[model samples]
Target: MKNTIFIALILLAGILTSCGSVKYFGIETFTPAEITFPETVETVVIVNNAVPQPKKPGYKYTIMGVEQDTTHMVADSALYDACKALGEAIADQPFFKDVRLYNDAVRQDEFFFQDTKLTPDQVETICDESGAEAIISLDRLLFNMEKDVFPFGEVMAGTIKVQATAVLRAYMPGRNNSMATIYLTDSLFWSEGASNLRTLDSYLPKPEVALRETAAYLTSGAYRNFVPHWEQAQRWYYTNSGTRWKQASAFAAKEKWEEALTIWQSIYEAQTNKKSKAEAAANIAVGYEMVGKFNEALDWAKKSLALFKEQTSDEKDSNVALLTLYEQVITSRIQANNKLNMQFGKE
Candidate 1:
């Protein structure tokens, strides 16, 4: 199924209010999988066991029934770069005591996917050599590449496309078992203009260049499977309360979260005016989110709604319009959070 389009669901007016309010909330846009390891697994090593893509140039190929034997066609480096990225990402986190990227690939003879996986014995030997408790083996990295020439204004452009699929297996030698094995598929598309279709190869880059660039994006992205990460997310707040908004905005700009929260909390609790109180409560919600206290953020959101309900006293009050819009915004957040929980197992 096509991914659900969030544009229609997003509260555009809330997007408007956030800019006006000088407030932002930390929304969990990405929920990566949790990492697992044996108790003895203090360090992990990554190795490439996949069959290497042919690197030799001067290979003849029939493209669109046109034959060409090209030179300077180097090897594909996607798997190697991905292996390095995974190790670097793990080392960047405090979660791992140590991480190593093995430069020497585990040479294999098989050219097919199923035949290229590392055996359990190979995994043990790699762990012993690298002095790692576990091993992340790149079993296979296969790419189906295609190039097409399409009309681009007065000229023509060649699109280089690739679908990369691979299997990565995590083995814990200490436990004598596999921790996690995942198959991933990623695709990339790039365009280069050409004056004519026949000369497209001359205009386009070497296949290895497109392969490396595509691999960089696709492989580094999949590395998130082993760790939790944060992604930028957009959220909205109320700024109609004017002075309190400015007061809170100043503190936020200074990065003094506690001081701003203090001011907003005071307005939320002690303000005599209902409108001011509700807006303050909403700001308080944003404050909680900014500090990564999502449960409190949710609680304050409920409190804001309750105040709105109290002010309306019925569904027909003039304040009901604002309340309805706010309700839609909150409901959208709840839906998004529910999706996050389901995907990441209730973080």
Candidate 2:
């Protein structure tokens, strides 16, 4: 009975070893923007064209049996912050020759708060005065807030939520139509619990501050639409009981990708097992990708996938799944690089 049990244990270990395992590593890849701008729009001016909100009506709330009145409305500072933050983010891009902020409010009489577009004359004037090639206007900004107070077990819990919506339009000096119109909305929330309602209220962010933060956050990400950005992504590699494979992974861990590629190439040439050869090809593809040889990287990735299909009987092999994803990623990178080159004014 002891000998039989030992034989079963040996078989289990062999099966586990043959299954293999995978290790993950991180890579930062350049991704294309949501929208691309024309080469003519090198300089941009951000303008505050929004009309500020009037005073809000007063409302009463009960805090621990005491009544209090409060009024909240959108402040002028929030609009300014939205414009300023967007301008700063655009300026960070090396493609833009200049970035200017027209801090003064341009529209003051929109009492009905209509969705008004900037006239061609206004766009030309702003571009000429700011020495910018394009005009980016904060057409309108709207804000609303809600507050709630409730009993949570024993203590009183208070929550404050604010939502801000912004309308932006882009124009070129000679164009009759706007280049782009974008609408963005963002929300902020704060919650706290205290023995009494008044303390919880004090702990929450003020309405004006919340509005400013939400607006700023909304505009901060808008620059990416006009420029390529870097995004961090993950990739997987095969690992097993081979000393040479372990050595190659060590070199890759230190980011010595050239040295790692040399070892992986040697392993791929000498490897007799189809699975081992496929793993080596996958690692080699990643190494070529790290070195900016995307065309070669894509070729090697295809080779790895074909080999994996031949050796993998289960169709759901982890190596096959990863190779499929890696192949797709390389293909996308190739396409995005073409767009990025155009955005950078390279042929």
Number of the top TM-score candidate = 2
TM-score of each: 0.70, 0.83
TM-score attained by model 2: 0.83
Q: What does candidate 2 score in Cα RMSD to the true structure?
A: 8.7
Q: Which stretches of candidate 2 lie over 4 Å from their true place?
A: 1-20, 53-70, 109-113, 312-317
Model 1, poorest ten-residue lDDT window?
Answer: 1-10
Q: How well is each residue in 73-95 modelled by candidate 1, as lDDT tens digits?
A: 34447778768776777677665
Supply the TM-score for candidate 1.
Answer: 0.70
C-alpha displacement of 258 in model 1, angstroms?
1.7
RMSD value for candidate 1: 6.3
Candidate 1 local accuracy as lDDT?
0.64
